[model samples]
Target: MAISLAALRQMILAHPKALAQGLSLLVLAAAYSPVSVLNLSPVYGSAATKLFHRYGMAVTAILGWFLKERIHEMSRGRIARLLPVLAVSIAAIQFLLFKLSSWLGSPFGPVITESFTYYPLLALSIAASAKLIQYATEISRYGETIAEHGPLIASYVVFNLAERISEAFISKVIGSTFLLTRYGLQLVIAALYAITIPSKSLVLTIPLLLLSYTSNVHVPTKHTTAVLNERIQPYGFELIDRRDSLTGYISVLDNLNEGYRVMRADHSLLGGEWTKLPGQYNPKVKDPIYAVFTMLEAVRLVETEPPRPADQDSKALVIGLGIGTTPGSLISHGIDTTIVEIDPVVYYFANKYFHLPHNHTAVIQDAEKFVKKSLASPTSPRYDYIVHDVFTGGAEPINLFTIEFLQQLSDLLKDNGVIAINFAGDLSLYPAGLVVRTIKHVFPSCRIFREDAAMENHPAVDFTNMVVFCTKAAGTPIRFRNPVPADFLGSKARETYLMPKHEIDASAFETIEKGGQRLLKAASVDHIAAFQDRSAIGHWKIMRTVLPDAVWENW
Candidate 1:
């Protein structure tokens, strides 16, 4: 031990910059990996940047500045070997840190669940940064020709580039198995230090490192449904199918107790349908679990002057196909349909699990891009009805909600056409107000309705799912024609919710708070982002009620 400690001390004194460079790389990896991991969790995925950016950045900066001297002094002592241990510990604990959620619970649970791997790894990374700063200061005292801030500047540039590259490529490559990828990269970082720094702790770390690799290997995968099922089946949940994909972790889960199946992405549920339990099998269309989706179909029922032609003659364009409930309904009615969905895996699972009919034109791509391209092309098909239902993971994609995007969607509609948008947000918040105002701004006549039973009181927080039905005819009021029985398509969910219900006063959103009527644009996305923290936290609590704790924790 003494000999190994002596060797590590010699290397630290001789190669402090070399060590700092390595630590800089380690710090960058540690800083970014957690963001990816948090994205997998339903609680943090929406507001991850806001949650960690403020606190983690402050902690890193403060520790790097205040502890440089202490870190420098400690480097010469026997305790220095333990510094590398901090890096290794991050990968080790994450294998089971999610279990902390049961003890911690929502709001606080997510914060604590992330803190386990985030802070320790960050502290160690800061120590490495401190070492570089100290070495740079010592060199400057002798007045040697060195770019004092050059190392940091270069490190910052590389760190940003790495962050961007990982966001673009690495995340796409890692997909849904990000849990294992995150830990695997962490182990690689630790191994880099152990191998390069040459510590005697390798005797212990080597075995533990091997064990961590194995533990990570057994981490969930598409093939490991049985393992996850073993933990969640007792709670009446079955993992039907799951995969890592372009958008997020896409999975099909069946709540056996409730006799319903839901398609999930990260923490948010895309959509679900009531399943055929032993006594409740329906040979016709399966009913939807959420009324909002069924309500969206009311876009077809919007009354038109000269009375629109039969359903078979009208064309429908659907953006964001969630389990294909809305579009599938459109297809069932024999309407020509085009679906623009971002994730192909979502499309695949929706078809495979939810029985999405294969008759529609599935343009598997981003909604915004698809709209822009369709608008640019003179030959693009115009739609009689446009359904926009992109809300997922507790937050709306702000870009899709912007005025420019909505105007493009408006252009895609015929003069007499109608559109329905499914949005989930707290009506009491400024962001939701902005979205409502923006939709109203683009579409002259519109009506908003909530999914569930009406809340008697409009409190400080009213988080709920709603559908907004709008029309291109400026002066005409958006009214739903009385539905004939055929409109229900044999779905009980439709019979009850096929028409928009629990009407929300559009005027209320127009004049909400100060400038509440302000429209949302591409530049105003940040304004909405600033307020998502509270909404995301509330959404997490709501999700906890939707699924058993075991489903989320096991994932």
Candidate 2:
């Protein structure tokens, strides 16, 4: 039942508008793909939402409308057949150019990189889409007339759906190696145009498609780790393992010179620890590279209303498992612990590489959903200590910081239970204040402590990690009892950072009675998300200082 070439050509000619509509969808998807890829890089990862999504959409719409006449003219000539091939070629080139992020250092590199990647891709895709729409309009004029903007409106709907569909497809279906899926889609679009349009360009398109297949898709998939390691080896870093998970691009990177390993999710470092490799600074236990994780363990030391039960008799819940540093410490202390991590890959890597203890319950689910369900159940257990440390990618997960979510966490805690929340941001920003204010609104008595001392000559907008400790019961001030030798667990990091110091005055974040700052809820969380550009940029600078440009760029 294979259709002959003549019959296929007749079918396409009879339904040019349908072919045009389908090709436009493919072109729109290609346009949105680079934004996701750019987010995987350190240079553009922080500001990508604003840089590409909000502004990229506006640019696409304006360019699509403006290019209509030019595209219509092109559609009448030889160039129309080449537009699809050119569009697909640009998408392949954009992915290749993204590897040049190391060469394009920041201050203005992201601007240049975006110019090369998203802007050109947008123009080419829009031109191709407009040409298709022109074909649709011409076809409709010979039949039942479409509305003046019917095809244009339909293309816009396709554009909007492209973003959401790609997101779901990448996260749910493709998982790892989504870059390959993107490029493959581009190739399919090119082939579709060659088949339907009937052009001599097929001579160039077939070979070019094969070349892209071997060079971009095939070779990279076969030797991705080897290629990545070769690029980053000069900086004493090694790509241990990486996967595109439901959360983001998760990687385990090792700093050979420093003898430490870090788990990364896109542009942010989740957690890391010193290794016991030869010639390295050996310790009794693998010490945490970041002191903030150790500081999270201070949840246990907080004195309760009546008084917290002994470690053996207490139960704990950890909302986020970042290398299982805090939860491992809690398990070692004999606290019955339950970890609720949204990404199973994080939990798996924590166990495989970071040696997370297996004694605790692992609820691999969203923290908010877990909280909601637990609160609904009559048999829901109350935790003596709950650790909420879900901050990542230069901004906290906005949903986790909402007043409603905080109240649920409060409900899940025993009457005297203590919750330690980790937040990373500049203190001067309104978003930071909004989060702190919301926490205080939920918990009447709370205290804040920075992981380290404020640096000398640091910028006014200091970006650092801080933990907020609060209690379910009010009136009594939240205080930490002195840690004894047992609390150290033989690790030097815990010995030093277990006691929270550098207390930030909780009252400092307090909004004035009429300052207009209010608690974050599900509806208003976007306010915090929208203002994270500065904070994320600040964090990007900090991460660059932590690891070399080559390490981030290669990934």
Candidate 3:
């Protein structure tokens, strides 16, 4: 009692209403799939999701209306003739929306399908254009020979459903696979299309699949922890800790020969000396720059009179703690210090492995939120020294560098307070220049210094660290001090670090105009995020040499 192929075909053909309903379901599913899948990730936030959802629904409604109008007016033969053209148009529009969404920095934006409203508008246009072209073609080709109203609507519905199902399946599979290999997904899409289309040749797809798999094959590399443990163990350096954070890697290495050294490998430092064991060897002079960190140490040399024993119970606020280097030194100096670090992993690894000062307070929160909360409370204690060193690898949190942010920081500082801000970047770039200019707009008196002196003043060098020392007082100046034996934690390594002789080249800051129209302030969180993607890309390139490409790829 096996059902014959002929019988099954006749049943499918005869039940036109059932076939239409099935196709309609497929079409609706395909149209809504992108938004459905996109919602699974929390990265886009509520504003973006709302925009996508609204537009997606609108597009579906418009398309539904157009399809209904076509069903009512067109004959079965005429409708059948239009299905292929409609399918191709739908595919083209979906791809276009994807491209446009990417270009606008979001899947939901003011243009294209970036907003919830815009997406449906674009989808409706696609559906209506597809339906109209299909209708015109059928009339031009078959004319009076076409059936006025039979099962043509059912056939068109089935084809439309198939196209949508194909779209959803293709988009999801490609999207999921793209996290592994972008080109591999492209090959997979081609193969899927080859298998689905009746007349298309599958021979070419076989070779492409083979080639893509070969190219994208993942081969594990040597573990970085093992390499670090083996190479620096003889130097009396023990690999005590390592942890990865959303921001970067925070590690702690202890040297039996000296004392513990806190290291922050921020996936952005290139050719720079890492303070811990497995330290970088013979780093190119142009490559290693620590000017910002050195400037942070310059807080010790502020021209204010030495604090009396009565005022010795001073508190310090460090906004961005990287491996707790400056704050570690501050705590060692007997100053009560509190560090506000956004990433908990950074704090955990820095303390466990980097041997950061254990006595200090650790507040894990976004600096902006913390600052706002602190400012709102007038009873908040003022900090004697505020070190704003938040630069991580290639990206600086733009909001942290804004004039409004600096103003809030200034309000939180004592009248005679000293602040050292570590700004790392290529000074030649517009972004860096803009940041420097913005800082100058807020602070009354400031002096900028490069972490390392430029041998020949080549501005084109891609990497460098700079520090800007700012004071609320109009005439305050900062000077560097030699590290004393007491400054070191009973380790000779302090001799090199205590009196770090990095010279300040103030000419670059002088060249930047103050209060100029070009000094744009980063006022919102959105502004800060706009730079993250590009900054991450730049940071990735710089970090490749410090840690092997395989390490980052694994993450």
Candidate 4:
């Protein structure tokens, strides 16, 4: 301890300049943090963040040169021999490890999502480049060019700023496609660097670099996964189709074991249906794999306490079509169902795979825009039933859930019309209560129901789907009659889950706590983002539990 104290004293008393330089380097390093570029946009490519680090190192190296710090460089012979040897050795090790793991059935290979050595390697390269400039280029006499590195320095600074600002940016795609493109391009650059160092190879290398850039210019994606050895051979659930949409990752997985197919938005199962023919179909089981899908059908059962109209006579407007579960049932019952789905891919897949009824009105547009337009038009038909079932991955379309939107729906609803909103949240969080409160505020007569009667594991907030049945007729009690055989539409799954059993008493959750009165308006939509994060994490965990790790991981 005394020796350490003496060393510290010496540094503070005598070696202050050295201490300042060391601290400055640390500060520079500390500035280079993992900036989350997950704004859910592909504007910035996967390689962009990696490039930012390189730019930063180059800037720092140029700065060091301007500061008259003597840098270190290796000759062409050293660069050629050392780099190829290093690259080859790493490749050989990785290949051998893969072989060993395959034979021994042991977990091997890089588990890290990305390499930690990436930035360090960039720093080393930049330092070496600066040193090369110092020795070979006669840079000591060319003092004026030091200022010319300003643009490079500015580029580095801009990258850091961009990374910091783009925390919420996420890519729409997260799979092998982006990974292959990103790293493949990077490897080519590395190869070119090794060859380009010698003057003779420039004739060959420049053309190759140009060809590589021209052929493989990266268009960004949301994320990329590290290549894993575990091949994703999903049992029964065959990937019939998949799409990367603005809303989320949509996939249609066919259950080979059950002869059913489901559409998924991100980690949440939107809806599913039985695909087997008459004799092949098991009428009693797995028709609507999830109870929530069938529960959505119960919106048909809401023939008001004030009794507006029966399902056959009702004009139903569905804001979100999740594999057409609710609308399909409505169409089956002869209701004039108009579905508003944002993603064309979802609508296409729904009809092609889930057997969605072709007779109903399909409005392929944003729910808000459609709603606004419908409200504006004097000749627009009012709806007897408006189903706001726009939920996925523990989060709802916040805009659809807003009071302003609900009020707009109210404007579009026929007198005494019913609306069923599907919300997935943890009952323990204030956000859930807030949402319920907002629903109640918009629709005076309403009843909430948990999708399933199953109890939650968490004492505080167990995330689950809950449907709120609201009516245009204020002060009228929300009453639902038991769905008879006719309402089942020859689907026994509807017969089983048409009535939501675990009805939540509004007395407990009707009032939100502090900052609870923040009723969802169009402007302040980001209020639910915090809640969404928690819910999304829970949903991800739940999905992992539902499917094998390899199934989700391989994507």
Candidate 5:
């Protein structure tokens, strides 16, 4: 430890500017890793997500100032003499790094994730690494050669680069608000590796490294879809399809023996449909294999809420389009459905893989943004049924769940309208309690039902999915018509479970100490987030049970 510190001190003193540049690379890696995926208290998560740009830029500037002298010294060089020489040297080093990295990480040249923007950084990093090494060599004691330290330098660059690159690919890069932040984090690291060091050990380490990485390598190809399927084969499943979008990682997975085709968004399963197609397994009904998906369809069953319009005459709005189960059902039944989904990839995947209806209007935008616009327009159309099925990545959209957003949803509804809000969380947690209280406040006469009525026997299973059915009328009864086989579209599964009376009723649980039972306005939603962290972790474990661990890890 003492030798390490002394060596670090000597290296910093000798080539502080190079270390500063490398620090930027380290920061880029950290920001893009699982470190950014933390589930914080509602208030902290909101502040951190929204203000990341301001803080990230500030950090970059601070790193620059710390390494300012090396930049200043580089500027002092003889440009006329060094210009061509440095450019040639940088190009040569970059070509070498690309071959080595591509062989180890990508099959082609460096995996050009975004055109050639990041490729140039490879040249820049190599040049910087070379200059930094030259500076260190010049400062060393007269008898020692820089080659003596080549092994150590290679270890540093390769280890850090490998960690950052793997994580940036495996973990979602969601720290920055701007699209620019999504650009090559690995490119910066590659750049620093180019600029700071180009040692023989980097080239020599590939043989042992090649084995662990073979099946999971990602490089864009015309056969990119084929590559994803090949990658998941080792995990005992086939990746039927996958997409990287602004919101999160979305995948459609199928295992014939498991008898289901599941849609996954990061760690959470959006929903699943039974694999029994018309001929192969040949089941009598088109029933969903997952009960939670059917629970979302129950809003259509609210009988006492309104009387006038038929399914064709009434309109329905869906907030989050998870595999389009509810909206597709609405559209099929001849309801004029409009879906507001934030992620375009999700909308696309739902249409392609989950059989989402294309006949209705699709608004590929955030629910918050869409709601704000709808509220602004004087002639905005009202919805007879609004489905608030926005659960994703183990949590509901925080902004949309706020009392303010819920009230706007109320405004968008017709006077006799009914709403179904699907939320997943521990029944014992403040988030679940607060959400229930808030819905009751917004809709007056609402009843909550658990997705699995059978789950009531297990007190250990606190984290579960529930749908709240609410009506606009305060004093009116919010009841469901007994679903006949026709109402279920001939699916016995839906007829049996869609409108089950099993409630995760607020009255059943003990009162939370010190008002965890309190209603959450937009301002108080932060407190709910603080409590929701454990629930999210619980969700992560629950999701693992739904699929194998290897599948989630590879994804």
Candidate 6:
């Protein structure tokens, strides 16, 4: 019963057309698979759990349509009828997997949730390939009808690709243009589909479209004057400009009657001190809980005397510049300060509204990239002080909190240099503990202090900010030198902020549990990803008090 090699070769040569048709279908299935995955990205955040179900149904429907055309024996009605059942089955399987992943305490929970879309697309691709194989078998028995429908098949393939491309384009254009008026666009989409589709199909689609529309409608109207007056406006500021960045909100505010102004990022209360206040000034606050802005003043205090001719010009490197507060302060004290700010909006707002010191150089780049480049070149002068104050949404940048990043800061600093890092978070959380441990691992000497000790000690009552001071040399006590009274008030806005009432105690750091583990310095991408989701949730809750939920929701 064994077939000879010569006979197999002859048969294969005789049915080259069928083989080619089957190969083409397989290629189309593969192409569609990746496109289906790409389609999931936009829906990931909004749909989250339901994304898989929706994409699975869409893929199944598409595959069913394709199969009905290819398999002449199957009626379109029969194939279409099976789509809902298959889609449900796929969704059930994905849901179970998602639940299992969550129960296992795996970091894969989000990935599994996202995979709902991917798995269904994969199933559809397999189904399409199976249908193509069946068609090839039928064509061989029926003397090959595929050749006759070649043009139609090609046109269908082109149409499917065009449809996907058009759908994506329309989705983006509509979503962006009608962002505030999404309900109207949803109605339009529903109406168009209703007019073109059969009654039964329209009935199913309209509800789905409505749900999708409702899920995505993000209007900016859920705001109150109480939020503006109590939380934001009472700071003696009026919001002149605001923009969303990859990091967070960057806003600029001006004093109504006075020439004073301030710039801020969401949850980043005060970045650096006022450099260009209207008149001469003295800081009334001594022993201030060093925020990102005031921490830069440490550079000015590092030197007991003016710079000698032999000494290199005192340079301060600031990793995250919110409103250019620290850099401005450093520049005022005659230090050559270089600020590296990743967000252009923050930089723009600082210069425009905050009246940032005009003398310093601004490098608009990622701190990691800048550090790496500076490290490779030995010619670059080491900084006298490095202020690492890039906090937003009540969480420190996990990447910046790593030991590798801290070591880079150490490399950039002079022998007597000091580095102050501003970290804002709940000390009880694993994120804060991990960050402090990481910093301690990198720098030999470190001191942790809260912005307000009274607030921090009351664990039941959550606090917003904390700063960690670290230096290369061992046993260097954290101190703020030469306290000056507020001489020239920049603005009423500045006056309200500059008054030092919040006192930080070193004793608060004693309560921070290290969890009986030695400090670890290196953190991989996985380490960061593991903590991000929980940290983001914690940050979201903290930020609600800083700004109204409506403001964050609107963004």
lDDT of 3: 0.50
- Between candidates 4 and 6, the TM-score winner: 4
**lDDT by residue (tens digit), candidate 4, 149-240:** 63235334644564454322222232235432322323433454445343333344454434433332122222211112113333545565
lDDT of 3 by residue, 97-175 (tens): 4333324433333233333332333343334334443343332233433422222454356435754675455443432
Least lDDT summed over 10 consecutive residues: which range in candidate 1? 139-148
| Tens-digit per-residue lDDT, 1-555, candidate 1 | 122565446645766666565555444554455443543354344454346554654576457545756765766633235556656665456546666665665555555654665654555555565455445434343233333454456455655565666556545565444443544445555666565455676576666666654443224444345667877899999988777666666789998887899998877889999886456546356788888888889999998776777889999999999899999999999999999998988999999999888888999988878888988899999999999999766677778988999999999998888999888877678887788888989999999898876567766667888788998778888878899988888777788888876898888776667644488888768766656767776777778778887787665
- Cα lDDT tens digits for candidate 6, 233-267: 54454555555444444445544444445554543
Worst 10 residues of 2 by lDDT: 139-148
Local lDDT at 474 for model 1: 80
Off by over 4 Å in 6: 1-292, 295-299, 302-312, 392-394, 454-463, 485-517, 521-525, 528-530
lDDT tens per residue, model 5, 50-121: 223223333433343344346437657321122223322322233223333213321122222211322233
The order by descending TM-score is 1, 2, 5, 4, 6, 3
Winner by lDDT between candidate 3 and candidate 2: 2
Q: Which stretches in model 5 have alpha-carbon errors above 4 Å? A: 1-188, 196-201, 205-213, 217-236, 278-285, 454-458, 515-517
Instruction: Report lDDT (CA) for all predictions.
Output: 0.71, 0.71, 0.50, 0.57, 0.59, 0.49
Cα error of candidate 5 at position 313, Å: 0.5
After best superposition, candidate 3 residue 408: deviation in angstroms?
0.8
TM-score between model 5 and native: 0.68
lDDT tens digits, residue span 328-437, model 2: 98998899999999998899899999988889999999888889899999988999999998866566777888899999888888998999999888876787788888
Relative to the true structure, candidate 2 reaches a TM of 0.86
TM-score of each: 0.87, 0.86, 0.53, 0.66, 0.68, 0.55
